[model samples]
Target: MKDTPRFAPDDRPSGGWGSLKAVAVSMFREEAPISTAHALLKQNKPGGFACVSCAWAKPAKPHAAEFCENGAKATAWELTDKRLPARFFETHTVSELQTWSDHDLEAGGRLTVPLRWDAGLDRYVEVSWEEAFAAIGAELRALQAEQAESVVFYASGRASLETSYMYQLLARLYGNNNLPDSSNMCHESTSVGLKQSLGVPVGTVTLDDFEHCDAVFFFGQNPGVNSPRMLHQLQDARRRGVPIVSFNPLRERGLVSFANPQSPLEMLTPAQTAISTQYLQVKNGGDIAAITGLCKWLIEGDDAALQSGARRLLDAAFIAEHTQGFEDFAAFVRRTEWAEIERESGLDRASLESAAATFAAAKSVICVYGMGLTQHRKGVLNVQMLTNLLLLGGHIGREGAGICPVRGHSNVQGQRTVGITEKPELAPLDRLAELYGFEPPRKKGLNTVEACEGVLDGSVRAFIGLGGNFVRAVPDTQRIEAAWQKLRLTVHIATKLNHSHLLPGEVSYLLPCLGRIEIDRQAGGAQTVSVEDSTGFMHASDGVAEPAEDTLRSEAAIVASIAQATLAPNPKVPWSQWVGDYALVRDAIEATWPEIFGDFNRRFRAPGGFQRPIPARHREWKTDSGKAHFATPADLRTDPDTPEPDADTLRLMTVRSDDQFNTTVYSLDDRFRGIYGTRMVLLMNAADIARLGLAEGAIVTAETAVNDGFHRAVAGLRVTTYDIPAGCAAGYFPECNPLMPLAHHAEGSKVPAAKAIPIRLRATKPA
Candidate 1:
């Protein structure tokens, strides 16, 4: 190992010299500082493209340097000078590459051309784009012939709006709605919860709202590594004396303190801005309990305040006008005892009441959360409880007050906005059929979890991944891979090589595509793609750097080509026409959602683009009762998706390293947690380690608490003592995914319970 594993308390700020050092190392590794420098200048700026790494909202009027360290790293990674030629693939066998780590595989560099798996030679052979597309089409056609439901079309967040719209259109035209996406694995819970509560699935707050907010509640998220750009906004909030409360299982460095690299004063001094005024270390799967506790406290306070004839803490007028089921919700909270709340949340009454007091004082509050809250069995319920808390303050629709589901990936929300959903809405389908002359499918399709189940049951035959490492990212790593192997064909359209590409199907095709920072040239010269940020800002992104390879196609072009190849005989839509002009795709999108995407092409070119109308943002509830609904605490039960663990079991949640984004590992070092040069380590509470009669740094095996007749074990994980809640442990995923079962997921969202897996650890022999 280059560096021995080290441990520190992570006392430093988030975006100071450490971020700069990491960015410099990444730029050096790419060996294209000049190109990367030019590209970085345009990143997240007006008249330029957005960063591919995250979906953090940018400033309306971007500063001279609006990009963050990770943004620079993401750009450099995409614009790296290294290239994988055809000869390299010929020299390396699939089995040989399988031995490489996920980082090492992608480190070999960007894919330069289309490659087809040669089963006979056990190596990938170069194939023309036309030939590869034809082969893929043939496989897809054959699968469709057997059963239209057999073919699953999957998309990742990296896909552009143009590509996502076209891909979904293609799937619907092909008589299938099997449009599974990365959202299925990430923020599906947020969508389901928010839609049920506020009648809108997207975030209600805007970038400008941050400046006016009185309080910000961050739940189950680490912005330091996941969304570094959010630190700038957070730091600004801190400076303005806004109270930021964090409810998480771990005390992440980003949420604790941050030094904005963009701030001159912060960079010049040792002083780091304190971010979280209150940090609640709620146990895994305890968010719903914690949030419910807060709600109950608020309910009690409001009731007392009403009895005294003092100013009511609750917004009585707003509740009466814009909310329903408040009486029932309040009754349930009053009936629920504090014993269960304290037992489940791992927190006492004092802390919950203190947080509630802070909420009662704040007029405008923003509640933001990430996968930590949604990757549990009660994920949807967790979110609904959060909404209930915000609703008490009449937080939705007011300035600086709303629910924000901070999504990963630059365009995951954009993918949905452009209609990349398993359940296609009737309005969009009808519009598409009227405008495009095709009968869009109405039946619900497979999600990420269901898609895997489909593969296992032989219901799904072909799998096409638009972008992302599906095999590695999904839960039950072995089972997912085995199911992929059974597929007739697997197509991966990506920039870099990863494990998913190595796990080839009977006839596999790897189609190389343009990265976000690469110029996308078609027959109509240069083209730009659009994406929506977490804040609902839809902006156009124009790539500055040259293409990694001329053979590589734009994501839009690839989807268009595939559609043309598969649906050729008098296709319903003009596939070739949209391939040459992305503006045409935008036109179709504008037509489909005229209210939301009016003048998409023209408005997208504006300074900061346009924000989608959020019904809840205007206090306009679009629910069945035309009002916001609060979930009763008693109504929520323990998530049935996760098996109840025995007394000896500990809940395990998967996290990402500071040096990585999603499944992309920049380096093995987790600088915040102070772990270095390895990904197979587990972060356990000191008490838990002692309880197991294990010493720190001891090699151990983690087995699932309950076995549902499926093999769920991840062995050889080095245990390290950390300040986590007792009986709770954390590990980085893709590595720890093997320990998670596919059947274990949130009931409503179907998102894998990655954050709350019941596990047990035992000491093992040193490697």
Candidate 2:
């Protein structure tokens, strides 16, 4: 960790010369040829490969450069010319490699071939694909003989829909439904909450809905860094004079203003478009109270309006016809005192009422949120409360009105749609049985948190990761990594080396796979895969660049080969045939989900693809009540699972830097926040720093504010003052993941409460 971080407040708006310079630097750092970069970037358009970054929807009418700065970085990272050959592994032992930082480890570049950990040599050794599959098959078969539930199949969101479909199928055919993916860590709350209220697990809005929306309400989402492509829509909405309201703990730069790099006029001139018409700095874990305040103000105003013989404030007809439990929700909101709402939300009554005035005046609105709302103890409640606010004004199932949960990975939602889930009811097991001629598993599977528990208890013997650095991404990182070594078997299908790969099991294998930007050649000649965006629209993605290594296989082929080697010759599942042509995979998906993915191939071939059927979008509720339900929060506090923190405990939230994507670090700089050269700094409010009697740049140790008998702490973090709310602190993710307790998760969704970790800081001696 650096002793002093370069702290320069950036007054300029996001996405101008800074973004362009970052993109160019990434290309140069990866040694990507200018021509090759241009060609690959051009392919990020409609018919080309999807950006393996955020899941923001692409426009139907695309621009020449449709990619964002982070998108370009992801492309360059995948298409890097650097390669890790057999000799590279021979020189670096597993123990030695474990000491390297994540960025440096991946900078060694793409894995060229299959490699297996040799206990005798204490290093990884190259192995043939046939031998690798045979060994993995033997281990899986042995594990299945004991208990199929002992194995875990983890999938990453970067995979294509075809690959995810095949991967989930392989897990079920082997006997258990222990399938967990990236969604378990991020948007599981959105899925669980929306389904119970709106009768749909996914968001109802489309990209076109942004066009007709009268106002946009953003909750805890920083689009400039997480999904830069979304800035284009916000810019357009701003130009059209639509009001944008933002609710977050920190005053994020993305929500304040933006200068689109794609705009020649803005780039040439000093013009920058302001994004948020109103920015409210809510306290961490205070969204429920903030939303409740809005609802209360609206209902009171409605009462006064009706008594005075003015126009009805709420859509009374829509509420009566399309919703239920409104009276109970309204009663609860009306009873909620103003003092509690103001204290919890960290905003005055005047501000919330003023914001509510804007919301009530708008005819239609789009409520958008991100992981900050979903990664808390009362995550499900937070989502349902936001939905309740929309229902008050009948802002749903209409042309510009709905809830939008902005997802991170490109195909995360698609993965869940295609059956990468631990819940059996979510997947059509009966249909899968009819299609595959085998009975699927009926018992529920372990989710990510439960899987970690299983691994710790020695119940889960093996783990097969489709893609991702699971060990680094999960909470209680140190504990999980120690338990991971005791596992019997571990298999990672990856494009490049990461921290998770270095933590090998007793019998572990690292198999190289082709990245999204590279050409995937099979017997079908050239294949195109599909991914569902955050807006529920599905589209085709085919690579135009050459593969980093010819021996690297596609993710679909690898999963298919493993299935073939492990399972008996099942006539229904022609694994090899499906591997030869990916259309067979799509056909099988369509057969399994005929209602949603009807005519999968034909529809995918259409320009800009088609939207998946969302029942709630048409005002058709699939719930038991057959109507959208207004769900009241269990209590006012958003962090209900954990006890209220003491006065000194500041809630800590993990965030992503501008130069990073999820767990992948492109550089040490957080350009948007103006913090450079280090990620080990803690962001705190100036008042909190003074109250805690800590210096501006003092070295500190943050310990978990829990009585769980576990000593969880991270030391040597330099404290830097920022514009965060009092009693709140912020730090980059994965670095702060270790401080979170694995058991501290959402009650229903089970997503780790990363956004509201209670911690108290103490000054540390200078290192």
Candidate 3:
């Protein structure tokens, strides 16, 4: 890979020959062309495994080739034939491995057995499963006996719902609510914001809603790279003449247009379908201002219509019957100055009015968003403002309109649904007390940000990860990696070796686990685990491929074993029995959350699975007042506490490249962005580049603009001119995560504000 990226303008539509070529390259690189091809056919099929990529909902009527380009890469990456035996670790010291890139570390291959860190040798040595489990169990028990809060169990969204349930149960059974998962870092703001407004934490829109909606509004989401499968739905909606309006800082190629690789007509003719009919380049952290502008335009238009005795623009009936706080919300919008909105949003009033016209003309609309709207200081407010825009037209609970927060992981939503949260109120404590014969923890626990703080402060002594590279995913990477070594014990149950594995604790163990694509067999026959999609659809995923290694254990089995070893002689939990038959785990889940998972085993077996009930979908608000409430933003500024940038300062947002998933870089190239061979690059507007006296391709350094007393910066980043807001910049995540301070996060959700970090660039001489 080159130190500097090769740049070119990629005008080709997303997901055509480029996508097919990328998929082929991924398969070839993994050296499993035939097996990967077979896996692709089975992906997202009714009887096949779910794609271990984005949580985009699978269509009710499945297509022959349901998986997308990135999905294929994820599957091939998982099913790679490469193996990392004990000898490989023996040859590499921990210090030596720490110098490797994240991609190089994970690409080394699947872990073949349990390994324990040998402090004396400064390397990892193979250990028996029994010994590893016993040691981990003893360490956890010791921690629990000392202080349950001293230990933290972190889970990734990749874990199955069954496994997640057992993992959370294990934590609660040990008498601590310190159960933080991947959602805390991504969509916790959505969960927090939507719950307060719509009274439901999950999205209200169903897959079928796309077909009925007249217009689709996209805010800060790039589906083509993040959730490629969604392009099919967008393409279908576009073909049906639905107008799509997008508001994002970057004019993402996926939102501009897409070509379906599966469509013979498109692939053969190289034809493309337009995605966003209107694109508004909102400034970073300006989503709230933009959304508030829309609401203001609509509300004022309705007032003028009433004066002229024209048809009412707002939904008077819905507001009166099913909502509260409308008068206050309307007053707030009416009083908000248009000039402030324009300046902050980086959009003229005409664009917002035009967007409002499109939105008001449509009988129904769907508002879709991603982390861009939910990873700010006021991320919750940003989401609530979008909800406010949807509420003006009575979009919520309608057949064709609602809010959709596109989740990243395959089962991140499911992990939260199955009780993998730090909040005690979200868990079914009453049922757990009755079933397990023990009082569950009632105190709130640490989230991702707080967990990092605990580790840094030496309050957290042990760390257990079910599946994820925690150290690579979190902010303040250098600090967290160093603090992680101070832990008394660290156990990672994973399918492959990642950077997090190299950051060993005092008594660290790496337990190899089965990937979702691989069959999970137990004392019973082959078992199936369920996952919930972004749309709250619960479906079973049957692993069609064989395990990479025979000694690997299922995540459920590993969690069960850990629980059994830690809390033995407790008959009520039945950890061994549940692990033997996953159906037993489902039974416990059903009994615990009967309202959502009622008839779990039976419903999971049904074709296409069942949709979990979303009360807001039926106008049944679950708020304190039992009515949907419009939330008034404290101010138009999304980051009220953040100081305004000077002439050289810019709001920098960390993003995922086309060739990468969360913290998992498949390659150094970001094809869609026209970046190749390097991840160390900064995307800046041409205007800003000239204003800062920096030329395109010039080496520069981005320093945090905040006065946090800590000098945070990333150097050796090549500047690339792009069509972005003048005062905003873009860079890939994990690399840019270092610029984000641990103290900078959403006020309520605690999600790191990676989307809008205040930064200033300085020219650097090339080495």
State the lDDT of candidate 1 residue by residue for 1-767, as single tens digits. Answer: 36676666567988888888888889889888888888888889877888899999977688777888778888888999998889998889999999999989887789998999999999999999989988888877877787888888999898889899999988987888888888999899988988999998888988888989999999998998889888877888988999999999988999999887777887898978999999999988888778878888887888998999987889988898889989998888888789988988898989989988888899899998999888888888888888988989889899888888999999999998888899866238888888877677788889999998987888888888999999899998987877778788899999999999998989999999999888889888898999999989999999888898788888888888888788745545888888888898899899889899998989998888899988788888889989999876554445564556566789999999988888998888888888888888899898888787888889998988765888688888988878789888999988999988888888788998899888887778642
Better of 2 and 3 by lDDT: 3
List of clashing residue pairs for candidate 3 = none
Model 2, C-alpha of 605: deviation from truth (Å):
2.2
TM-score of each: 0.98, 0.99, 0.99
By the TM-score metric, which is better: model 1 or model 3?
3
C-alpha RMSD by candidate, in order: 1.5, 1.3, 1.1
For candidate 2, write residues 326-405 as lDDT tens digits. Answer: 99999898888999999888888998998898899899899999998999999998999999999999998899989999
Task: Give stretches of model 3 more than 4 Å off.
Answer: 1-4
TM-score for model 1? 0.98
lDDT of 2: 0.90
* Candidate 3 residue-wise lDDT at 474: 94
Over 1-767, each residue of candidate 3 has an lDDT whose tens digit, in order, gives 44655898798899999999999999998888888999899999888998899999987678889999999999999999889999998789999998998888888778999999999999999999999999989998888889999989999998999999999989999988898988999999999999999889999999999989999999989998999989988999999999999999998999999999988999999589999999999999999889988888889999999999998889989999988999999998899999999999999999999999999999999999999999999999888888988888899989989999999989999999989999999998998899989988999988999999999999999999988999989998878977899999999998888899888999999999999999888888899999999999999999999999899999998898898789857788888888889999999999988989999998986767899999999999999999988998778776766678899799999999999999899988899999988899999999998898888789998999888677888999999988899899999999999899898899789999999999998898642
In candidate 1, stretches whose alpha carbon ends up further than 4 angstroms from where it belongs are 1-4, 635-638, 641-645
Q: Would you list the C-alpha lDDT of every candidate in the order shown?
A: 0.87, 0.90, 0.91
